[model samples]
Target: MFARIFADRFVLLLLATILLASFIPVRGHAAEVASLISSAAIFLLFFLNGVRLPRHEVVSGVRNWQLQGAIFLFVFGVMSAAGLAMSHILDNILPPILALGLLFTGILPSTVQSAAAYCALARGNVAASVVAAALVNLVGVVLSPLLFALLAHVGEATVSGQAVGRIAIILLLPFALGQMAQRWCKPWVDAHKDLATWMDRISIAIAVYVAFSGAVVAGIWSIVRGDELAWLALAV
Candidate 1:
């Protein structure tokens, strides 16, 4: 069982990435390049997701209002409340910014591709996962900034028109284009589902690497104590 779990390439790659980032965090121009690559990989990941997702499934998924509503409530309401409670509990132990970051995470959307992929693997409702993830993100585009401003007392300028434009360009536009070409692309996509799965994993790995690299460069290890990380692990 241990070997089976470790044999999952994504898990191994993610662990390797965290270790690498701790030892040799990307900085300056290298970090910039990694950021760009991560962004491009995200676009490709979403595009492929669109190509693979059946239109009928999307339609049905959208119509599952009950499931979507539950997911939204969990993400925006319960999670946010929990984050606030945790932040207060950990404020004395954790850096203020780190506590705030934890709170901020609760207000974010459900992860899209990863959630859908996992749901499919678990023989659950993958279509609902896809729609719910997308809906949560769309709502979060507006709601997250407001929540941050209210709960964290932070400035609300983060979710501007420019941010929306970037989201549209990087996420929605590619998905839409892929959907438009789905009729012609479906066969190839179906035949090579593993390719799509690996692409998604690689994109996620790239994102994790870039994120951890930035954290390492910013002296995260120095700021966060081992006990704090242990607490974080339990909380997560």
Candidate 2:
């Protein structure tokens, strides 16, 4: 029981972090510093992720193009279209930022590590799921933002050139650098996989906390009422 709960610590951490942000959201100069720290945490998280993945596996994952292509079409294509349609449907009902979030979530990549595990649980093709997830995510790092730009409305939200640059510089560039260093770093990474996993969890929690801190201060509660949030959850 304890092991299971410990294994689910990331989820618990996220819930706790959200509550903390709701009660005591970072403000003013502290908010700015938190943002910078989150950025750096994100940079390190992606860098570690880059270092961790085996390049050979990634290349192999790429060679399985049919599965990758299908997933790509679904994740970056069909889902984006669905999100765009739904965002429009809820235009009068939901807040603009919340509606935009619908599109953003649609464009976001699949959780690579979880895909294979889920597939295994369902007694599906775990190998195919693993490779397809990896390849799709690798491409998605670039494709998601571009797709969002294409699908979203004029003012609801915008993925500016700067946002793209940040994604590239802060997210993709580090991952690429990690891949380049993978040959030398792989052994160390393998030995300390548990440490890396903890780092990943902590970094993600920090990012979420910082983001919600801003949202909390920006009147996220005032803008999104309780009923609307319930409806949004159901719609999703």
Instruction: Give the best candidate by TM-score.
Output: 1
| Tens-digit per-residue lDDT, 1-236, candidate 2 | 77786667566888999999999999999988988887887677667667876676656666777777888899888888788878888878888877888888877876643554345435566446655765666667667766776776343333456655666676667768988988888789879877666666676677778889998998988988898988798769
lDDT of each candidate versus the true structure: 0.81, 0.73
State candidate 1's TM-score. 0.88
As a TM-score, model 2 comes out at 0.71
Question: Clash number for every model?
Answer: 0, 0
Full-model lDDT, candidate 1: 0.81
Name the regions of candidate 2 deviating beyond 4 angstroms.
Answer: 1-7, 88-101, 107-159
Q: Write the per-residue lDDT of candidate 1 for residues 11-62, one digit (tens) a residue.
A: 7888999999999889999999999998898788778777888788878888
